[model samples]
Target: MSDEKYRETIIEQAKKDQSAGKFQSESPGFRSLVKSYVSVVSPDRKNIITEGLTAIYKNKNPQPKTLNLIDYLLGNVKYCKEASDVSYAEFYDSNGEMVASYSNGKWISYGTKAENARESELWGIYNEAWNNAARTSQKNSYVAGTDTTIGLMDISV
Candidate 1:
């Protein structure tokens, strides 16, 4: 079959899948998150475009894993930071279970169970935590009294 015909067939199948609950729609928040990430971090935003095209053309699921938003961000950071040459330094939790490691520029963690493993939840948490950290860092950049000045308007007598 021709490429056009194949694409048409896939679209039809996707429509059917949607009707049959074989597919799902992403939440607005998720879409916004993706858009924001693409707009900000991705070089040329090609990663976002490539992912979108993959889902549309190759029928790849946009939600590749069950991870939460923060976890996803952390994972991406991990992948980018850790390349492949070096592994993170291992660390364990209070219970002696290995939890997190930092290598290159990534963080790794082993969760309690497979079901509770790295997922979008992790991504969400990571994002939240990272944001908070970033905010603190930004705040620290303020020069005590020099960064801000209080202005008072003269009151009419």
Candidate 2:
């Protein structure tokens, strides 16, 4: 098919898929489809245009993982401060009680009521950050003209 015809086909398929709920809003697949559509619609546009699209996508899909530990602590806890950073980083609450610690690619949470309650939230943030970092690293590695393998972990994430 011609380029224009193929673009039209993609648009029609996307519309049908959207109406059928084939993909959730702000999902990676949805974002990819949108980017493909935008690219074909205006292939010669500058990066600024794509940057706008990125802002829109980011606004629609706010990733908690983008927030650092300090941001998380300040937003959720009464008071927090970094305690130690010799081998690992530790955060303590206002009462000088250990809230959570990060070390060796893992997080340790004290068994406090607040910590317990926010455990899942913390994990979600961590996982999102880890996945994004992994993806960016993979993309960077492929920038040297190497053939890249889209591993199962990337797809699942």
Candidate 3:
């Protein structure tokens, strides 16, 4: 089924479940159902959905912090060797133009393309890398934070 259609189906089912009292509000089943709906949503829509849910649920968890582009790249496998142990780090395109730099926790983007590296694609590969890394980090942290192990098996059994 199309993603939109699947999402609609899940919503309809959720409505039915709610009216029939199949799952109580704030119950584990309700949260699981919400997660199912959220999983199929597109990225932009997910943000809007999350905002609405946050308003309703008033989530109290602290938000995960993402590293800035320069900070992210400095520790990244591909770029780390270039600036290890230095207080400064700079990214350059294949054409030898300076794209961005990190100094004393500040990021500066070169050229007229953008007021900042985060706002400009002129940072190119570095920007993409940082975005991918940040997204992965967020996903990993979410999974790690939410996962629970119920119990261990008895080896004697």
Where in model 1 is the C-alpha error above 4 Å? 1-87, 114-157
TM-score of each: 0.20, 0.22, 0.22
Q: Model 3 over residues 18-96: C-alpha lDDT tens digits?
A: 4444432434544454444433421233333233333223323233123347533332111222212324444443333
- Looking at model 1, report the run of 10 residues with the lowest lDDT sum: 75-84
- Candidate 3, residue 70: Cα displacement in angstroms equals 3.7
Q: Which of the numbered candidates is closest to the native, going by highest TM-score?
A: 2
Q: Which ten residues in a row have the lowest lDDT in candidate 2?
A: 76-85
Q: Write the per-residue lDDT of candidate 1 for residues 27-118, one digit (tens) a residue.
A: 34333433443233223223433342332333233332343565334232111112223333443322334445556656544443321432
Report the CA-based lDDT of candidate 1 relative to the real structure.
0.38
Task: Rank the candidate models, highest lDDT first.
Answer: 2, 3, 1
Judge candidate 3 at residue 135 and give its lDDT.
63
Each prediction's RMSD to truth: 23.0, 22.5, 23.8
- Assess candidate 2 and give its lDDT: 0.42
Q: Whole-model Cα lDDT per candidate?
A: 0.38, 0.42, 0.40
- Model 2: what TM-score? 0.22
